[model samples]
Target chain A: MLTKRIIPCLDIKNGRTVKGVNFLDLRDAGDPVELAAIYAAEGADELVFLDISATEEKRKTLAELVRKVAEKVDIPFTVGGGIAAVEDVEILLHNGADKVSVNSSAVKRPELIDELSGRFGSQCVVVAVDARQVDGQWRVHLVGGKVPTEIPLYEWVTEAERRGAGEILFTSMDHDGTKNGFANEALAHISGLVNIPVIASGGAGEMQHFADAFLKGKADAALAASVFHFKEMEINPLKAFLRAQDIAVRL
Target chain B: MKNIVIIDYGAGNIQSVKFAVERLGHQAVLTDDAATIKKADKVIFPGVGAAGSAMSKLRATGLDRLIPELEQPVLGICLGMQLMCRHSEEGNTSGLGIFDADVLRFPDSVKVPQIGWNRISGLKSDLFDGIRDGEFMYLVHSYYVPDCPEAVAYTSYGIAYASALKKDNFYGVQFHPEKSSTAGAAVLKNFLETVS
Candidate 1:
């Protein structure tokens, strides 16, 4: 059986991990490699590094960080944020990043998904959608859910799958940071609309929220940031909780 | 010291494979050169992406002709393993004809690309000596090699398929051992040290 994955997302800025990761055992919290190794050892099914840097050297710095993490960590990880072109994904994959996710750029050009999947195979391309409910309709957002677009969520994910995106990472903007739960209704709708795997993101406040995302939303995987970063929830215990709920998790 | 050569025909994640070898205290050179691959004591063929394009690159470099002829111990990963077979449904590509089996896409009953960790059972061969039955391996592919005569290990997604296969000196795994944590690393080390 293919087990459901638990992913810890790390935000990167200029080759370092941001966010208040309160792992007291870490000598350097900003060191993404060490943090990645820790997460891997602690049984994180995967990791995602969102490079939010806007420097001229952001590419080189992220590439360097990717190389370090790949050398030390033994689990698969994805790199995203500021990924607008094929060349950016090429350098990151060359440095050993397993997968690359495209968000605003895919909405901007749409052809970027086709070119990426054509050049590097769909398995390595992850299409991330940030959206919120707008008057009983889900509207897509860009740049960390700041810029809004007229495109509806269900139709967009259907198109992304057709465009050769192997997976869809759907983050509900309205439920984000509220720590209530995932947007299961919309997630279930997207899952039914696409044949590919769906990753439910945002609104993961409790462990049962993950279960609901899987059982209710029908998500293939679930991703969270602050809860895992702040030690409010640990991956192993979370997996244990999900297992007790009769969910298939990699123990 | 062993000369490890990774066939780099511009197909897949060659760097991670190289680093995985390095973690085992061995050095591997990524080369498309036939001479380098022929001279190596061991060869690791790692690939990801489309079968047609990967086969074309191998054909362009003449690695397609060179690979099946090499007598040294060779291991193929993911799409590399599928290409070692006779044919693949992906891109409607014909393979190198190393394995007698054919590659197939997973049924619509299951997700297209069955991602994440799945267990390998019915294990045999030196590649899984220390690894136990039901030990998980990382796999990410829509197409799979059905259980055949060469199958030494199996995994069940929508159906049981060959997760690993062996014939004479050649070995292939549908999973990415380099990315599969400790269990996967053990498989790689077993390949480099014992599977000869």
Candidate 2:
């Protein structure tokens, strides 16, 4: 009876926490390290720090930020965004990131997934797929969800799993900034296809949204950004609500 | 200063376990030396790799014999705990005969490497002090020990298996406390405080 997890995502740029609507118009949230410590203290199941900037300047800053946050919190944390090589994954892991998430890079060089999984074991690698509804069909998006890949959403997920990715992080680009609810239809479709843990991201407006994500969407975890960063919702109350709903959450 | 010795026989996640014990306000010494392991106030044997290989490493260092005879409390984690049983199906290897159970692999119909945070219910030991009946603990094991008299906690993945075991001075958990959050840290702390 493993309980479903609830994670708060923090986007990092220039060594600071930033969040935006659909990956644009970014605003400063807080210091990345301090914000991470606060979330961990507030009982966030896990944290994901995505480096929005891929430049050398931002990369070095993000790596140091990860190291600082790793020293502050005992819970597991993951680093993603602009990670293009096996050396990048190793550097992040060595810098105290429990897992390294690959999105665009995973789609570009699919072999990197196998090479990383073969070296570090599947448990440490997470394949992040950004999907959007195109012509009433879900298609995989690359380059931060701006470019569409040739692979279908479900097929790409299966391929990533076959390439030895431990978990699949599927983010719905169309529903990302809406905050109405999760793309349950897309999540349900993918969850049924993959045996590995599927984490649902994008379009979480209310506490009930998390419940729906787990119950109907069958997501192993639900990750949200603005709702948590802007104090629109607090974790303990949301967890309390989920618990009242009889959803298995770590209180 | 209570010295907690973690046997380091080239097993898995040794440093993390040592860091966890040290973070809990105790001295955790990672050692394979029988003399130091025998003299520690409490011992923790944590592993994450394959069972047969871990047992082979322990045998190479002769710690397989030195562990069970210790008068102090010893906590075995993951593969370290599984290797304390009569035999393990992993690599078809025999283990230290401390528990009267055999380690087994789940059926093909069920998922292999049952991972994530699962609730450990039916708890009946002091190791669960300050923890609720169905506390969720993180687990990542491919093989499990079948339910036995020593089972203090049971969790159901595909089938109900022994989540926690207690046999005299030897205690074993199929989960990693170092990896598990607060609930797990409490289990390790309770083991250290109560098992003397």
Candidate 3:
């Protein structure tokens, strides 16, 4: 049986892990490589490094950071946030990121998904959709959720799948940072609509939320940032909890 | 101090495999040079992409013929494993004929990619030495090779399929051991130490 994945997302800014993860055991929480090793040791199924850095120089630094993290950790990790082209994806994958996620750039030019999947294979392409409920309809948002589009969440994911996206990382903007829970209603709707695996992102507050994302939302994997970054929830115990709840997880 | 060659035919995500080999303290090289691959102590045939195109690239570089004839230990990952079979449903492509098996698509009842950690059991090869049954390994694929005489490990999704296959010096895994954490590293290490 395939196990539900528990992912810890590290927000990277200027080639360093943001949000100041202050674990006593960690020698340096700001180091992306160090934090990634800690997460991998703690039983994280996967790690996601969202390179929030915008400068070209810092992006190069992110590549170096990715190489370092890849050397230290054996688990699959994804790199997202500033990926805008096939070359960007190549740089990260060459530096040892298992997959690369594209968000705003993929929406700005949907054909980019086709070109990427054609060149790198769909398994390496992850189309990340940031959506929020607007006027009782889930609308896709762009530029970090400040801008809205006419494309509905379901329609966009369907198109992404059609364009050869291997997986869909769906983030609910309204629930992001709130830690209330995942947008299970929306997740179930999208998961039913697509054939590829859907990763539920944003709005993970407690361990049960992860279980809910799997059971109620039908998500293949659940990704969280703040709860893990602040050490509010550790992955090992969380997997144990999920196992007790009868959820199949990699322990 | 063994030389490990990761056969490269423009496939994506070979870097992780190379990194994993280096992490095991071996000198790993990514090359399409047939001579280099033949000279290596062990060869890691890593690939990601469509089977037809990947096969085309292999043929164009003359690697298709060289790969099967090599006497050294050869481990194929993902699509590389599928290409070792006799045929693949993907792209209606014929394979390298290293393994007497056929690759088929997972039924529509299950998700197309089966993308996540899955357990491998019924280990029958030294490739899984020191690894327990039901240990999770990262898998990402739509097509699979069914159980055959070469199957050394089995995993069930919609049906029981060969998660690891072995025949003499040729071995293949449907999962990405490079991305499977410690257990995955152990599998690679076993291949390096015991397969020879």
Q: Which candidate is the best by TM-score?
A: 1
Please tell me what DockQ candidate 3 reaches: 0.81
Q: Looking at model 1 chain B, which ten-residue stretch has the lowest summed lDDT?
A: B5-14
Give per-residue CA lDDT, model 3, range B1-196, as digits (tens). Answer: 8888999898868888988888888879899998899899999998888999999999999999999999999999999999999999999999999999999999989988888899999998989988998888999898999989999999999899999999999999999999898899999999887888
Off by over 4 Å in 1: A20-29
Evaluated at residue A29, the lDDT of candidate 1 is: 36
Show where candidate 3 strays beyond 4 Å.
A19-29
User: Can you write out model 2's per-residue Cα lDDT over B1-196, one digit (the tens) per residue?
Assistant: 7888988887544655765676678778878889999988899988765677777888888988988798898898988889889999987999988888999987755444465678899998889888898887777777899999999999988789998899888899997776577787888899888765
Each candidate: RMSD to true structure? 2.7, 3.1, 2.9
True contacts preserved, each candidate?
Answer: 0.73, 0.19, 0.83
Instruction: Report how far off residue A204 is in candidate 2 (Å).
Output: 1.0
When only the first chain is scored, the TM-scores of the models are: 0.95, 0.98, 0.94
Candidate 1 CAPRI assessment class:
high
Give me candidate 1's interface root-mean-square deviation.
0.6
Return whichever of 1 and 2 wins on TM-score: 1
- Between candidates 1 and 3, the lDDT winner: 1
Whole-model Cα lDDT of every candidate shown, in order: 0.91, 0.83, 0.89
Mind giving the per-residue lDDT tens digits that candidate 3 earns over A30-77? 678888888888999888888766786977898898888888898888
Better of 1 and 3 by DockQ: 1
